[model samples]
Target: MKILTIVPAHNEESTLDSCINGIRNQTIETDILVVCDNCTDNTEQLAKSLEVNTLKTINNVHKKSGALNQALDKYLLDYDLILVQDADTIIDNRLLENAVKEINKDTKLGAVCSKAGIKDIMSSK
Candidate 1:
């Protein structure tokens, strides 16, 4: 099955690399689409450098949700499966495989989502 994972990003240059790496290391390879929205950083450059598909969002009024919607409306229907991943997220290696298994096991599965945990926390020293 052709799977497309959409990653909505805005000024997330620092975390983007990790996110991409995590995706790449997944057991089930997937096409990644990153929506770079109103980014002042080098997010687009980084994505392009990694050879990942990227779309620059012209409308940035509604935050990440708008960027996500822009991608979904224009390109969502082209794939058999879709995953909306955050820019700062680094998914576990088993996530894709596990999700696919669950989805395939049942015909009624419309979508599968995973829980996210904080990767880092900072405290004023």
Candidate 2:
């Protein structure tokens, strides 16, 4: 199955590297595309340096959703599964592998999702 990971980013330069690296290290090999949404930072440059496909949003006013919409519109028909990922979220290495496994088990499964885990700031203290 052809899987494409779309990362919607807006001035997320600080966290983009980790996010990209996490995607790259996924157990399931998939293509990565960074949707640069109205960014004023080095988000595009950073993504390019990481050697992944980059898509720049055109005057996106709806923020992350709009940015994702733009990318989905253009690339939706190309890939079997489209993974919409956050710019700063670092997913587990087995995420795609586990997700694909679940999808394959059930023919009715249209999508798979992982709930985000919040960092406990108090635990660090």
Best prediction by lDDT: 2
- Estimate the TM-score of every prediction: 0.90, 0.92
Which stretches of model 2 miss by more than 4 angstroms?
119-125
Candidate 1 weakest lDDT stretch, 10 residues: 116-125
Q: Residue by residue across 1-125, what tens digits does model 1's lDDT show?
A: 99988999999898898899889888998999999999999999999998999999985699988999999988877998888898888899889988899899989889887876665523321
Mark the regions of model 1 whose C-alpha exceeds 4 Å error after superposition.
119-125
lDDT of candidate 2 over 14-85, digit per residue (tens): 889988998999998899999999899999999999999999999789998899999999999999998888
Clashes (candidate 2) = 0
